[model samples]
Target: MAKVKLTAVCKVCGSEIELPEDVMDGEITSCPTCGTRYIVRLKGEKVELEEFKGDVEDYGE
Candidate 1:
């Protein structure tokens, strides 16, 4: 078995975001440049990215 990498353009910084080929739908990852969060989805054989909508908890609060 071999690993494949998937890529998407960040909606915020326009940087390319590379992800694992086995990445599942709703998996969360961050952009390296801007550190913006995104959720990945399976769009047929390809993947799509969307801004993460889940609430962020501040443990320091």
Candidate 2:
């Protein structure tokens, strides 16, 4: 049997974002075309992507 792949569209750059079959809720995924980050939301077999505006921590400093 062939593995099934999930995909979502990037709202920023209009690119297709591939999601893993085992993806969980609150999983962070980013757009390859643009640097926009998104948060994965799952509810009863429904999947949704929301823009992530959380602060980025700089550990290099």
Candidate 3:
């Protein structure tokens, strides 16, 4: 199958970003405008971008 480029608006900067069709679910992508990272989600023919939340860990402090 041929790869198709897709577009999604950034949840942070609201910038329309082009996403690669080969991008898998849960993949992280960053916004070029605000430099915010987001997780890509695929819902049928629609695409959703969610802000990335990092997992917390203790460094034995």
Candidate 2 clashes between residue pairs 3 or more apart in a chain or in different chains:
none
Cα lDDT tens digits, model 1, 1-61, are 7666789989999999999877888778889999888878888878788897655563113
What lDDT would candidate 2 get against the real structure? 0.82
Name the lDDT of candidate 3: 0.80
Which predicted model would earn the best lDDT? 2
Best by TM-score: 2
Model 3, 14-51: lDDT tens per residue? 89888886888878888889888878889998889988
- Per-residue lDDT value at 28 in model 2: 84
Q: Backbone clashes in each candidate structure, one number apiece?
A: 0, 0, 0
Worst 10 residues of 2 by lDDT: 52-61
Query: Which TM-score value belongs to model 1?
Result: 0.76
Candidate 1 segments exceeding 4 Å error: 1-3, 56-61
TM-score versus the correct structure, for each prediction: 0.76, 0.77, 0.75
Question: After aligning candidate 1 to the native by TM-score, how far in Å is the CA of 9 from where it should be?
Answer: 0.6
TM-score of candidate 2 to 2 decimals: 0.77
What lDDT does the true structure give each of the candidates? 0.81, 0.82, 0.80
* Model 3: pairs clashing at backbone N, Cα or C within 3 Å: none
